[model samples]
Target: MAHTTKLNTDLTGKTALVTGGTKGIGKAIADELAAAGARVIISARNAPSAESTHHFIAADLTNAQQASSLARQINDEFGGIDMLINNVGGLTTPGGGYSALTDKHWEDELQLNLIAAIRLDREFIPVMTARRNAVIIHISSIAARQALWNLNLAYAVSKSALNSYSKALATELASKGVRVLTVSPGATKTPPMEKFIADYAAAQNIPEESALAQLLQQTGGIPMGRMAEPEEVASLVHYLVSPAASYLTGSIYAIDGGALPVVS
Candidate 1:
């Protein structure tokens, strides 16, 4: 008889920095990494409304000066981290397609969803290159592939750019003992998503449940029949960043519950 046991995902000596880690998928990822034994640090423009175990730093990543200051502060205080989760993106622009979107709207969307991560990576990758087995995870979205132009034109385009950037960065760093990967989650039940649904329902004068159904249908209907829990996405991220997934890199891992119709 052979004995079998669970693989250890312990990150006892590793340090992790999760951007926008105060809430939603970022919060879930931060919590999961901490549980896996990593010393976690979270950053956002504002402090969390609720108390948390992780150290919180205030920095608006959209600003280059603030981002540089944030990196310097972290390197000074914590000696730099082994893991970087670029999870500080959102749909901050309005809907109504390209006609309604201005140059500023597109620029703001890119700043939040794409450029912030790029700046942070530039600041951290030098230190990370000197370390052994460092990881960078970009929290992307399914909209990168199946974009809904009417509702998320600018945001989706930004994520598409992010996905491309992640792949390129991963390739460049593959020989440097650093891993870079992207996690694309669809229809996650986060606070912003819930609010989007609520607002949509009000706009259409329909019940919340009906609005949800319609929205899902527009996205080709999830085979799982519901939005993914934030922790579910976190679990996948935990695996990818763990030592158990040492060989994985330069890939976009989708956690979309079969919502994407095409096989890529």
Candidate 2:
């Protein structure tokens, strides 16, 4: 038999560092963690655009030195991380086809989606290992399984690498008491999706609804016929960090509205 999670987990004195937590899914996760009584440090290249801040540390993750420095700052301020969420990532361009993308595009995509997380984790894990209890969550994308439509070659490849790294890290950390988990979200209702729908509508001179319909058909229609809200993905992350999910580790959870053709 299984049970459900409760809101009373009360992480009152715990500290967490959430990369890219300024907006979208990252912002949602930061809010959930804060509501459960944790003190969260949200980091981004600029001052957080959203109010995810109980505290904010600006850092550009594209450089490994900055990532290491940010990790050190977190250690100095919070003592050590109890939870770490690697959420800084995005598609580098709209070039939608492989040939249209250049070497620079691939490098940029990989830096943002895969390499940044690895750099930060290298700094974070050792700090957490000393504690004997901690959790790290990586936000991946559905392209990790099915390819991204057209010109997102680099983005897809980066996510695939991220998925592989996340699994390997999870296995290596379990015995040390740090749980690493990953979430892959498809067609989520983040700011980027809104822009995609709007732009496609403009390009085709169709209503946004129609454009979204055609877009869904081109990819694979979500059985639920709607994109997931950021909060919905955050809910799963919340549980994975909670004691309730202590037995779960080294797994990838896809929250894609049943868009994948096969069941895992």
Worst 10 residues of 1 by lDDT: 1-10
What do the candidate models score in CA lDDT, each in turn?
0.94, 0.85
The root-mean-square deviation over C-alpha atoms between each candidate and the true structure, in angstroms, is 2.8, 2.6
* Distance from true location, Cα of 155 in model 2, Å: 0.9
Give the 10-residue window scoring lowest on summed lDDT in candidate 2.
1-10
Candidate 1 segments exceeding 4 Å error: 1-6
TM-score of each: 0.96, 0.92
Compared with the true structure, what per-residue lDDT tens digits does model 1 show for residues 1-264?
Answer: 542323657888999999999999999999999999999999999999899999999999999999999999999999988999999999988788889999999999999999999999999999999886999999999999988978899999999999999999999999998999999999999999999989989989999999999889889999988799999999999998888788889999999999999888
Give the top-scoring candidate (lDDT): 1
**Could you tell me the C-alpha RMSD of candidate 2 in Å?**
2.6
Candidate 2 per-residue lDDT over residues 1-264, each given as its tens digit: 665544446677778888888888888888999988888889888887544446888899999889988988888877888998999998766646877877888888899999999998889888899986699999998877887657367788899999999999999999998999999998898887788789779988999999988878866799997899999998888888877777889999999999988878
